[model samples]
Target chain A: MTGWLSIFKREFRAYFATPLAYVFIVIFLVLSGVFTFFVGGFYERGQADLLPFFAYLPWLYLFLIPAVAMRLWAEERKSGTLELLMTLPIGISGAVVGKFLAAWAFTAVALGLTFPLVITVNFLGSPDNGAIVSGYLGALLMAGAYLGIGAAVSATTKNQVVAFVLSVTVCFLFTVSGLEIVQAFFPDAVGKEVAKFSFLTRFNDISRGVLDLRDVIYFATLIGFWLFLNRLFLDNAREAG
Target chain B: MAPRLEARSLVKRFGPITAVDHISLKVEAGEVLGFLGPNGAGKTTTMKMLTGFLDPSEGEAYVGGVSVADDPERAKRQIGYLPEGAPAYGDMTPRGFLTFAAETRGLTGAARDAAVARAVHALSLDRVIDQTIETLSKGFRRRVGLAQAILHDPDVLILDEPTDGLDPNQKHDVRNLIDGMRKDKAIIVSTHILEEVEAVCTRVVLIDRGRIVFDGTPAEFRGRAEGAGTLRVILPADAVEDAVEQFEDLDEVSAMDRHPTPDGRVRFTLTGDDRIALINRVTGVIDGAGWPADELELDAGRLDEVFRALTSRETDHQDSNQGQEVRA
Candidate 1:
């Protein structure tokens, strides 16, 4: 427990120890505000709920979460600290999960700061707080899903810029794969599978106030699968030096 | 009790290339093993396997009796390693990093605090404990890495080029640290500094081409130099046959080579480790034979030459003067 828990404590504190946490939180709050009020037309489409605000959380996370995760393994690899970290007594899986949870919790904090939208909606009209809770839950899961992919991609390269671009590209595919237009690029049979696996589709489902067990399990497995790949890459990628 | 650390026929292969080939080592407590090898000779790979950071391709490494491959967590718990570059977290302060190392190594509460304090004091990191590692100088960062490795005070410690980038004073300090801890920990240190072997290593293992070419005491390594007790003896050509017979029979002469000088004198070059006695014996033989000889000289022995001779031809970059230029 000390080995695993200490990694979580260290990585989490590391986020706040530098300017990264403040910068990320401020940017996240500003962008979510801009996209919600002006771009998504939160006021004009007001039926007394945060649907307009929740609609763009996926797109906002598409870039921001990767920015937070770009340094996860890429920075370690670049500075050669990956060797130091791996040689520690902590199991690699524990380190991976701890690091991933730290990032997830940081994003959750950034997402949590958007509670003003819930307040504004409830003040204006009768809003279902339960749906707002589910929306936040779905958004956090989607962010974790994005972070999982970003961390795995980050493990593949030492250049953080390359990690950012690769993560954004992969996450974008998972984000829009279920869209009607994007699905047309695939064969009819393959298109259905792509839709079923699309992250935004799951987000939309859970945010609608119906939290299916399978949907929760799907997101969990997605995060798990990416984390598993992240570990495999670390095991082989760190062998060179 | 089992050896503190051991590597049994450890082999690591990348593609068709065998980085560490059939390497086996046993490091017991109270011994500081100097891992001597030129660059690309697989010193880093062997240490990586011993620490359970890299799995061996063909064999096993044991840290305190647990096989690293079969149970890396338990094996790794007993070994503390510093990789080739002494990598550290640049964004973390020394205080934060050492505390993290202590906690991860399973030290908690007062014990963890004491361990961190001891490591910091041992490495003299008190001045820059709060400084971010990236902002610290290279020497300080290297010290921070050492502090992290030794915070737990494991029974087996493996450091790769621990003093690679330090100044003379810092090098002496690190050497003393290793020496001070040698009574309890089995340590393996890989270095290109030939003098460090003499200063710190209880036994030296000279590796070349992924194989152990020479393993012995430092004195033995020096004796194997190109000219430990080498002598140049010039005598009349008529007496060369009789001199050769007498010199060949003497056990003091390990090897002898003959050359014909332009002045019709024969020069015999003799190599031996018993220097004082070799000179005395050769001079007596010359005096007893009633043969006038000239130009008798002995070399003081060169360790750098011995290093290159024992390694491979790839060591052309090695300095002949000494360890002044033997950088890996």
Candidate 2:
């Protein structure tokens, strides 16, 4: 009802007003590139898929998204700007959504700048553009999930380090749930259930050119759940202040 | 219609500590109410409740009659709040901050531009609007906070320590600025400086130990100085002792103090409600004693006296409450 477009605009531009956006984009691209070309054997694998690049994304974003999102509310709280923000006419939900979208969008821009990886894959062999698109889709959704968790953690404390550490810990749990190393400790039935909930498993399915509705729903629900938690944490902090 | 802002028995507590306790206040349109208190007197807490940043534990605050606890989003539309620290995004420039404030308040297109310009001009913020907030001086930062608080031109303005970091000249400038806004908006400016109340505030509300101890006009607050009224009496040094002794027993006289003078003129402070009546009594006492007075003067009471009288009692009262807290 209120014009949230203004909130959307301001938050979107705030990322670029400082070095935060530039630093984040440069770090994300360099690390993703390193993992894609040098570490993941992008050239040696000779695969028509973006398996090398997609494989490192969950880990890459685990750290990067938190760096981007950690200051979303934590800095606001630290600087006493949360009071200034909360007094504005816009609804809390709108501001949260706008901020989350802006951070996610910044990551998306960084992700898009990695087009050279797609180009390299195309140069070596004809890679399926459809799978590549889905890979990027899964990567973007996973980044959102990570950013949402980061936003939630950022809302909990005024310390950015604490927010970053907590976000990585949460995202790592979600990623490693599907790995045999993590699942081996559990009973067979529980292990499979945990693996089914793994972020990597759902995202891996999409990058394999499989448009599973179940995987889409998993990512969407994870994002929605974490965002809901983000809002709850913000409300608690507001009431606490 | 119902004053610009109202709080009905608002109470805010954190665990065992009560920050704001059963405080109620009203601010009418076009009136500046000076919210006066010492540190930790719940001034910030009360302002936070009014701005909907903190939910009251027991009661409601209304901005333009819209309850903050009931509908904070709606209530925020009618009120502008400058928080205690004036916390702003340090990375953003004043331009960015004001634009964000304007947009968040729902000003659009040219109206938004015009509002931003007016706020910048009103606060004399042009020099630093494009610079990051981290680079601004403390005075400029406070002005930026002021600009954001009034960017929307809301009906009610709640400023917590508005001139805290400014120099005397800047304080005078800000006082003039607040005076200019006195025609159409209700303002609540909280400060530890008692002089600001006398300078710009129409009414004074003194909070102590999370309670309103005094609420009245500046004149009434000054009138509360019973033991500190300045009095002038020009009598010979021989008659001075007799005058001090004779006049010190009046029901209104609380205490007396002599002022240093080279001439034989008697100078003393009288503790009384009516300075004129005290003066008449002193005249009568001195006239019959065959002392010819050369001059008689009655200076007004200073707010410093009122401040000390009220806050000194507050500290003693607060200490007793703290003892009760320890026992509990």
In model 1, which regions exceed 4 Å deviation?
A: A186-190, B229-300, B315-328
Worst 10 residues of 1 chain B by lDDT: B319-328
Model 2 per-residue lDDT tens digits across residues B124-186: 999888999999999999999999988888899999999999999999999999999988999
Report the alpha-carbon TM-score of model 1 versus the true structure: 0.86
Error of 1 at B235 (Å): 24
lDDT of 1 by residue, A183-238 (tens): 88999999999998898888887788867888888889999999999999898776
lDDT digits (tens) for residues B1-328 of candidate 1: 7789988998989888888899988889999999998788889888888887888889999888898888777888888788878898778899999999888888999999999999999999999999999899888988998998899999998999999889999999999999999999999999999999889999888888788888877767877876688888899999999999999988888899999999889999998877767888998899999898898887757777788888756645444545665433
Give the RMSD in angstroms, all C-alphas superposed, for model 2.
Answer: 5.1
What TM-score, over all chains together, does every model reach?
0.86, 0.88
Minimum summed lDDT over a 10-residue window in model 2 chain A is located at A1-10
Instruction: Give the Å shift of residue B325 in candidate 2.
Output: 14
Q: lDDT, candidate 1, residue A208?
A: 80
